[model samples]
Target: IRVTVTAIPIPMACSPAFEGKSIRKEEMYAEFGGGRSPAFELLRVRPEAEVEDGKVTVIGPEIETIPEGSAAPLGIVIEVAGKTMKKEYEPVLERRIHNFVNYGEGSWHVAQRDLIWVRLSKEAVKNGVRVEHIGKLLASKFRIDFPDLLDAVQVTLITDPEQVLTAKKEAEAIYDERDARIKGMKDDDADTFYSCTLCQTFAPDHVCVITPERPGLCGAISWLDGKIAYEISPAGANQPVQKGGLISAENGEFEGVNRFVRKASHGAIERCQLYNFMEYPMTACGCFEVIALVLPEVNGIMVVNREYKGETPSGMSFSTLAGTIGGGVQTPGFAGISKSYILSDRFLQAEGGIDRLVWMPSVLKEELASRLKERLKAQGKGDLFEKIADERNAETIEALTEFLAGVDHPALTMDSIL
Candidate 1:
């Protein structure tokens, strides 16, 4: 017997607030990922001959078959082929899937890369929407958004438990390889960086110049992402910023960046030091993954991510701290950065590097454990991770200072950050 659910027309314009809106457990018809089961989204550049234009395949159960209030494993693999398509563009396109999927009238999507959570509304199912509709939505949206760079697009949706697990593993490997390739790339290695004005809709003066070492504050766009974005739409938000001259190698100040920031911010920001938080740090647009604040009492910096709702050593919650630093203001001693940048060799090089990090939320520390360990080993401070304190160890400034003293944290012996 054929079953038909009602279908609602996709919205032409999606509200920005809808992107962050979450679906509670009680409200969702079906949930995916969110640490419940294996799930991932992968995008790949394929040879022209290997792709069938506009084809979307569903390997397992369709949306209507999923039990209400059930959590299911999900794997989304998108393949695109075009003369101009490059491997560097895969992640950029993959990231767009989140936004495109959210454009659906009754669907909600959050997060990106391997950590994704999605919910299909019962209203959508009642409208006769199926899993294949998501594939079509993505394929159509990509063509509309990147017409010049994509000649064909195909999407594969997997829900079978065994298949989801296998695809997730493969996606993880691909993700690691892509990350390694991007990590090997350095800012100075390129003659041009890219500017992202995507957040300008919310903060008009904010302009983010993304580099290999410094990804966007939102933790979404990388250097390669910016590059492809410029290639596809030269006049778009992502524009190429020629690296004209170097002002300070130690602090990562550049003549081109200074000029770009002044023009982009309409003269509100006169100067910016890319790798330093103590000087004229880059202005934040409010979507930053983490905020690094100077903790003068401990002579170090405490990192707080958006997910941390508790009080920080700075005696401020993440929201309160973000308000003080964000909105296109050149707030000295406060820098907004991507989580991956925390692992880079260029992470706050002028501000004493990782040695200056004193405290972070336990979840943030655990998330970066492997990377932090590797970076520490490279710096010949493999034991420093142990020396750093988390929320569990210190919640107040005094408590953090005492904890650092007890641990003999190197920041205590370093030059005063104040």
Candidate 2:
């Protein structure tokens, strides 16, 4: 059978505004995977003989047939084959799906991996957009973006509950394996690290040196992601950073990192301590997943994520704290970090590690529950996890201090964070 390509009309005249625009709940025609149902997007490298180029298949009802305002289970599986396609680049390519999909007019995508949440505006659906169009859009963009790395691309968009369930299981396994591989990997294991200048668009001098133990502050790019990005585009935002002589292992200072930061920041920052917050902390680019700040009064640190709206133990909200340290300035006693990095073995090793953590949003704590427990246990502080205060436990520094004292929090006895 032969297939025909048709251009689907996008709303808002297909302007760039649609690229990163968010579709609020009321504006959404349909939504998927914001804890509503099983949803995932996966990409795999397949042998040339196994891939059917340009194939776009929708396993269930098309978008046009679905009722407006309905939520459905969705799964996207993309397979590509090329002479140069490597398995290591699968995650990198998979991540592009979010950007490509969001570029479609009236389409909004947020997050990534299994926790992806997407919405199609009523305007797009009314303009004859179908689920298969998503596959087509993705295939077209992938081929254009990675002409040298991808020879054939195929997309399978599934909406059937059984199909989504089966696909989600497989996707979860892949995600787990990727996470495990990254977890087992260490910064010391590599002779080279990577620098991500993507955030430079906002903070021109900010450079993110991504390592295995510490991913990008945005919680989006991993060490592997950075490596793949550099391979794909040598002059792109992600570039290789040779790990030169170690400067101070205790503070995670490297000759190469310091030199690179100085050059990248145009001498704005002369030094940076990767594993410490109080001494020459890395600059924030405003996209960090979490921010940890010293609470001098309590001699501890309070952690807050981008999602937290209430005041933290630092007497500041997330937005307030973000503005203070962001924009490529190295603020002592303040550091931006990824949620996953909070569980890494190298988490703030210089400042007493996780033991320095005194407060975090309850939601953030709950999200990292499993890994937090394991990390704490490895540090022989398994019982300390329960002692950490959240917004519900204490919204003010005074209340937070009292709660920490009551729980016999370890941070109380640690070195003064100030």
Candidate 3:
């Protein structure tokens, strides 16, 4: 749905025009998340009796109380009640939080789920903006955008350190639950893949190709979510792409996908590989939760998430590299991805799959540790998990090489990444 600027009781203007706007460090008043402190955002479908329309509550510190230019903890919990809203619809709606929050001209938001990092400009606080206003904006927009599906929307913004930490765990558990819904389904299981253009406003020529194993780059829409979204609104941005004929089974190129991506990108992109990360892989929009790139110096690859602010062994920060590869362009040797996509059986298949991975953030490694172990064990590569390096192990390519050699990581002996 198109974002419309409406009369909301917030000091800053809200519109799609600000969705891509950046608030540099000098312009900030307060910042949250981005690994600064615990932070999360969650949306849930609640019973009709549990939600109160237009209710917005700030559980802790208000704008006036937060110290200037300091990092803070935050948790946004939204509860919605509607006859048509189902548990399956939560993720798609939850993702709208990123877009709507970015709508505020003085506020900048990046990433999603618990990895969200937000900034508020001093200019906005001077105009009387407060934390509660954010909740008001969300409650107002959710109703305005999904009038047919939502009868009531209530938002609770938690800034209290204790509550933020508590709510974050609740949100993470739900996120894990949502991610498991499409497990065991493979790309070969379906003849028809799905495409979503919901991010066209951010990247005009982008088309999100969603298969059973790979989700949208935003990490929000799954293959089942795509089918459900299409069923809900046939005329909506999500549509099905028939996998007409196989172009390259190993590289995950399909004749019908090529045709659809060509038309969807308005001829900007002709071919998209569902699994290849080193050559003409899927195009990237702005909101990918993670990014994977080839580390030619080491003949391996490194994965970086949005929450990681430090430089990787490849000599670039996540944000810096994202700027180079994003905007719906197909960048060979690099690909944007969702965190869950790392566990997929098809991840980087063209580059020798998981064996090519060498470095990631320590936090990300811990987050994926449990499930990653299971996947590695299934592949009889459980020993490979300990071979991977994080920032804690090495922050530079030279250091990474030494670390890899010491650990005897498999990527050191893999085929040439190029």
lDDT of 1 by residue, 1-418 (tens): 2223223233322334444444566667898875566677889999998888778899888877888888888898899999988888887778778767766656676556666777887766777777777787778778878888999998899989899988888887787776677778888889898888876644668888889998888777888889887786778888888778899998988999989988988888888888887888988877687899888888898898876779988989987997798776778889888888899888879988889889989999998999899889988999999988998999999899899999899899998777
Q: How do these models rank on lDDT, best leading? A: 3, 2, 1
Q: Which residue pairs show backbone clashes in model 2?
A: none
Inter-residue clash pairs, candidate 3: none
Candidates in order, TM-scores: namely 0.79, 0.78, 0.95
lDDT of 3 by residue, 1-418 (tens): 4656678988889998878778888999999887887888899999999999999999989988999988899998999999999999898788789889988988878778888888899999899888888899999999988899999999999999999998898888888888888999989989999999977767888888999999998888899989888877788878999998999988999999999999999999989888886667888887899999988988998999988898888889988999998888888988888999999998988889899989989989998999999999999999999999999889999999999999999998887887
Candidate 2 on 122-202: residue-level lDDT in tens?
A: 877777777877788888778877999999999999998899999898988887677676778888899888988765644
Off by over 4 Å in 3: 1-4
Tell me, by lDDT, which candidate is best: 3
Would you list the C-alpha lDDT of every candidate in the order shown? 0.81, 0.81, 0.89
Candidate that beats the other on TM-score, 2 or 3, i.e. the better one: 3
Candidate maximizing TM-score: 3
TM-score of candidate 3 on Cα atoms, chains taken together: 0.95
- Residue pairs in clash, model 1: 5-127, 5-128, 6-126, 6-127, 6-128, 7-127
Comparing 1 and 3 on lDDT, the stronger one: 3
Where in model 2 is the C-alpha error above 4 Å?
Answer: 1-30, 34-38, 59-73, 160-166, 199-206, 218-220, 244-248, 262-272, 278-297, 304-336, 360-371, 390-399
